[model samples]
Target: MFIDVLKNIVITIVTVLIFISAVEIMVPSNKMKKYVNFVLGLILISVILSPIVKFLSNGDKEIVNSIKSYEEIFTDNQNKFKSDNVSTLKNNGKEDTKKELFIRNFNKNCEDLLKNKFKEMTFKSELECDVDFNNITFNIKKLRIGIADSKVNKIKKVRINKEKTDNKEENEEYSEVVNYISNQLDIPKEKIEIYKLEE
Candidate 1:
């Protein structure tokens, strides 16, 4: 019985060696070849140790159970990683939406305030702001005001030996508008710009 068992083991090993050689010849020489070789090495080791392991444990079910448990752990970890990435993306989208809403509301409020203060003139406003997401702070960088339409008439004054400039009244109006915006919005005068829109 011992001699027969030895012969069977020798035949099994020689068959496995021949199969491994055939597989190696068929596999391409590339990055994937190393991975294939590693898997085949593991199979070879397991086959060589099968008899000793069966003698000690008396069954193959324990090995299969251990492999199944490892697979379960790997799948659980992969699922957790994917969920974490999805949640991070959602949070980033929410933050971007919040910033857009804040900017839109701020511009609307400024335009409304100017409209109420200067009843005779129509104003359009644009604002540049620096936003800090970490601290949730907004810093006003610059404000641009465009005079879309004006109903105020230019006052003409008679002067002795004075050359009249066509844009003098418009310049004065721009200065006044700039000063008003600077004071009301608590922005620096230099940081505010006022321009008349072309008709």
Candidate 2:
């Protein structure tokens, strides 16, 4: 935790200094001041970038570590899922067939409705979906909107519209939809908005 905090502080300070130096370079200034600032900027940048260079040069150590952790989890889950699927396939063949049919139909309808809906907006850079099975609610999170960094004009937009439905079939339908959006948009799960709905 301490290391994480230190890393964040270092990144923040380096980012600020880089931005300041960039501005100093762009704006016209005295020759002496400009040269001095440029030299100092180079030194500061070297100091700031050294750790990052070392970190990256270690052959992506952190990324490999994260991948290994994910691999372990996925392997465990795959084994459990395979066993459960085998048992389910044996015990409830009819139910499994019915569920598949419903899922297919539901997905077709959703595709027809959501096609080309998100392309009209400019400020809304990305879209995400969230579903809560326990509470039977579906939610969406739109990024680059209502945030100062994104410069979105909230007043121009009326409101965010969401669809709600009730029933196990509808929940299954939403599950397919949310999963589709998550994959297609390349958005992270943490960035997705989650809400509770009837179904």
Candidate 3:
């Protein structure tokens, strides 16, 4: 490679010198000849140093090319990261929708089951649950049941100053319902709450 470069430099110098000599011979006046010779001398010097200058500047070209390549790679990685984030967001939205659907279905099924067992009572249920997406497991946290007896049309009003009293019959009925729910759903009674609904 070094030999080839040297050969090309020598050939360029010789060609430039020959062209300068031809221009010098064609000069019309002695004063113009002096100016032309000075210009030709500068051209000759440039022709001789061009190979060395090009060799030094070659590294700069390589650096520019390398920087451009790195920039392209960085842009590609950035675009990929953005796309991955967008896809992850979409997946999260889908999971949220699925979780909501599961909760709604679970609440409806529980209400239907309770309604079937207690025909004289209407049951409205609200439940809180924990779902593990990775493991695909569900844990019921709390279950709230609002019970309204179909036979009762009006709720009795109680004064705030009156002493609190427990109705044994109502307590026993609530306990039985709680026990039945615990046994059927495999849920602890402590997590279940039964409330009387006012009409």
The best candidate by lDDT is 3
For residue 158, what is the lDDT in candidate 3? 67
After superposing candidate 3, which stretches have Cα over 4 Å from the reference?
1-64, 153-173
Q: Write the per-residue lDDT of candidate 1 for residues 11-108, one digit (tens) a residue.
A: 98889989999999999999999999999999899889987776468535655666687889999999999999999999888887877777788778
Instruction: Write down the lDDT of every candidate, Cα atoms only.
Output: 0.77, 0.53, 0.81
Q: Judged by lDDT against the true structure, how good is candidate 3?
A: 0.81
Q: Candidate 3 on 1-199: residue-level lDDT in tens?
A: 4466578888999999899989987888878788888999999999888777886879577657777878999999999999999999999998888888888888898889888998998888888998778899999998887788878455556656433333333435588778888898898987887777777
C-alpha TM-score for every candidate? 0.53, 0.30, 0.59
For model 2, the stretches where C-alpha displacement exceeds 4 angstroms are 1-14, 17-28, 93-199
Which has the higher lDDT value, candidate number 1 or candidate number 2? 1
- Per-residue error for 145 in candidate 1, Å, reads 2.3
Give the top-scoring candidate (TM-score).
3
Per-structure clash totals for the candidates: 0, 1, 0
Which 10-residue window of candidate 1 scores lowest in summed lDDT?
162-171
Instruction: Encode model 2's per-residue lDDT on 20-69: one tens digit a residue.
Output: 77877786767777777777678777777766786779737766876797
Error of 3 at 59 (Å): 6.7
